[model samples]
Target: MSRRTLSILALSVICATPTLYAQEAGRIQAGQFDIIPSFESSMAYVGNVAYARDNDPKIYSWRAIFSPELIAATQVDGNPVQFGYRLERGVYFSSTPDDYTDHFLEASGEFELNSRHRVNALAQYEDGHEDRGTGFHWA
Candidate 1:
């Protein structure tokens, strides 16, 4: 084929390529409820496991973390409401006594009595432990 014919064929093929779009695949609906679930995991090597300030022992260890979350939302009586739960777990290879897990729970609601007035409320609960020397922290 001639050079001009080859150029036209290449141009036509490029213009005819299809376009693609991406959509969220993690959302699910069940009986007036919207549920979304997600998870995250990580692993790291720590040269010093102890969060010491002075000349404390510098313990080397490997840490692994895993976190999972679930969210559910819906409309109740013309009001928007949502609930969520999350769990975080940590494991230490050398620092076995420092291994810990945490839990968090939360809920929120929004109400509109009229066009001129609105009300909202949120509640949260957390159960966890802080690092050494930081004192105990919980809510």
Candidate 2:
């Protein structure tokens, strides 16, 4: 095959690949509720584990982070309601006081009283900790 034709074919394949794997934003319907679940994770190499300004000692370690969330929604009396929870965790190879896990809770709902009026509400809470020196210290 000619080089130009091969290049065109490669470009077309690259453009079409994303559509093949794309997920629809619509939630999964289970009974009377809609559910959506998602997860994310990352890793990094830290040359200086502790963000020390000067020279006591430098610790090297690997850091990992993970987060997962679940969302559920339902229609109540022609109104929409949603509830979700997310958890985040971080760990380091070195057992410094920096490793921690956090939890978050969220709730939201919408109501339509009439054809021209609507109401919405949202609430959220978090229980977590910050690493030393980066921000507030708990110890």
Candidate 3:
């Protein structure tokens, strides 16, 4: 089989595992952190890290993720758009290769819908590799 065909076959088998479907029934903790330095400058650094832990009797899963990015661009009145890319990887403490690996590219904007409610829109282009597939999210 070709490389892509073999990859698809493997992904299908891995995702079909029953353990991948079970959900944790107990407590779970999750955390995320991000640092962006001089984002409006010609050079910038972006990084994010997230972690989660779960404990349950029937199902169990934990996950940790890290994404680091860089960008270079020109300024438009101190608010400039940069061309950049990010790399994200994760490991599930109780899952398989098919249950992990989610990487994405994103663009975002925000607006004030009201005094108590604000609206934000984010566009993401996700590349799930052999695990899932490419998709988009608007939120």
Candidate 4:
């Protein structure tokens, strides 16, 4: 199977695990703490403007995310988890006369584990890059 397919399958299994789903009402009502982590990466290109010629430059970025949920009987934490992936790529140009522009892409996915709880996973692929990387994430 392709890497994408395999990654998705693994995420599904982990997210759907009984341990993640079997949190009884009593547990939540009493009080509990949950922590989630995530990672993301993106790439893009830069170009020239009206007066200047084409100047192509590429950029890459990676980010880490952390979310904590606090639950109490009186004040419950709204939802349990939130997760997703985003991809962005664009071109820009600046010159003495004017400027130029381009476009990028984005995709995301998430799942809610009832009215007060949620889970999610996501991945994104861009157009141009030498090291194309995808992450396996869950929250």
Candidate 5:
């Protein structure tokens, strides 16, 4: 399908879904921190399960994804701090070899350096992989 058509379809699906709020999605107050847990699951028809090369025959499949995440936020001496961890697992019905699992970790914070200037920093770590036959071989 054309990009434009896909974009429109995606938009339509999003609009048709009921509105959801973060507070309702997953929020828990713990002491001085808010611990939020979220889960996302989706099933889609994948056109290319193996991410086949141009010359290779196409391999189609059905893809199912399960993603879960946890976020903690609080204030340190009035400075905001946040940390999050997310895990994603994908399963392909027709192409079991294409299944994958990934992890992502993130943290950010703000510090008051005196009264006039403030410092903000963010750090992220990801353990992820691309589908077979995709991306370059750095080696």
Candidate 6:
């Protein structure tokens, strides 16, 4: 196809695509805190499975991932306090050895100090792993 025709086709395809918008979290009311629970699942294709040079053999794989998250927030003495947790699990149908599960934890709090200054604190932790070709490795 000519360059001009290809460009026009690409432009038309882009213009025909639908727009996507983020929806606000639907919060659930608990006894004292508001909770937000969500789940996400996706599939991905990896062009290279191993950290190999172009001269070496290349491997490709596909994987599916599922994640669930929950967040809870409340006010303690009019100060905001929150806690959150999320877990992600990956399943590789062809490359089982590359599958992994990850856990995430978070906590945050805000304290009002007098009428002027306030203190905010946050802590987060994640137990996750890097893909085969990602991150640093010791020689």
Q: Is candidate 1 or candidate 5 better by lDDT?
A: 5
Predicted candidate 3 versus true structure: per-residue lDDT over 1-139, tens digit per residue: 9864575455445434432111233212222212242211111111211222234123344434444454333343333433445665554444444344445576654556567986566566877654322244244
What is the model-wide C-alpha lDDT for candidate 2? 0.73
Q: Write the per-residue lDDT of candidate 6 for residues 1-139, one digit (tens) a residue.
A: 9864575455445434543222355788899999888777666677677766659887776666667789898999999999999998876645667879999999999999899999999999999998786678676
Q: Top model by lDDT, which number?
A: 5
lDDT of each: 0.75, 0.73, 0.41, 0.32, 0.80, 0.77
TM-score, model 5 to reference: 0.76
Higher-ranked by TM-score: 2 or 4: 2
Superposed on all Cα atoms, the candidates' RMSDs to the truth, in angstroms, are 16.1, 11.3, 18.0, 17.5, 8.0, 9.8
The ten-residue window of minimal lDDT in model 3 covers 39-48
Tens-digit lDDT track of model 4 for 20-133: 222444343223532222222222232221222236343322211122222222213453332223332222221212211212233333556587986665444444432211
The TM-score that candidate 6 achieves is 0.73
Candidate 1 off by > 4 Å: 1-23, 136-139
Residue pairs in collision within model 6? none
Worst-scoring 10-residue span by lDDT in model 5 = 12-21
Mark the 10 consecutive residues where model 4 has the least summed lDDT.
93-102
Model 3 gets an lDDT of 0.41
Determine the C-alpha RMSD for candidate 4 after optimal superposition of all C-alphas.
Answer: 17.5
- Clashes by residue pair, model 2: none
Steric overlap count per candidate: 0, 0, 0, 0, 0, 0
lDDT of 5: 0.80
Question: What TM-score does candidate 2 get on C-alpha atoms?
Answer: 0.67
* Model 1 RMSD vs true structure: 16.1
Model 5 misses residue 101 by how many Å? 0.7
Please give, for residues 1-139, the per-residue lDDT of candidate 2 as tens digits: 9864575455444434422221456468889988887666666678776666676577776666667788888899988899988898876656447788999999999999998999999999999886655775465
Could you tell which candidate, 2 or 3, scores higher by TM-score?
2
Query: In model 4, what is the error at residue 32, expressed in angstroms?
Result: 35
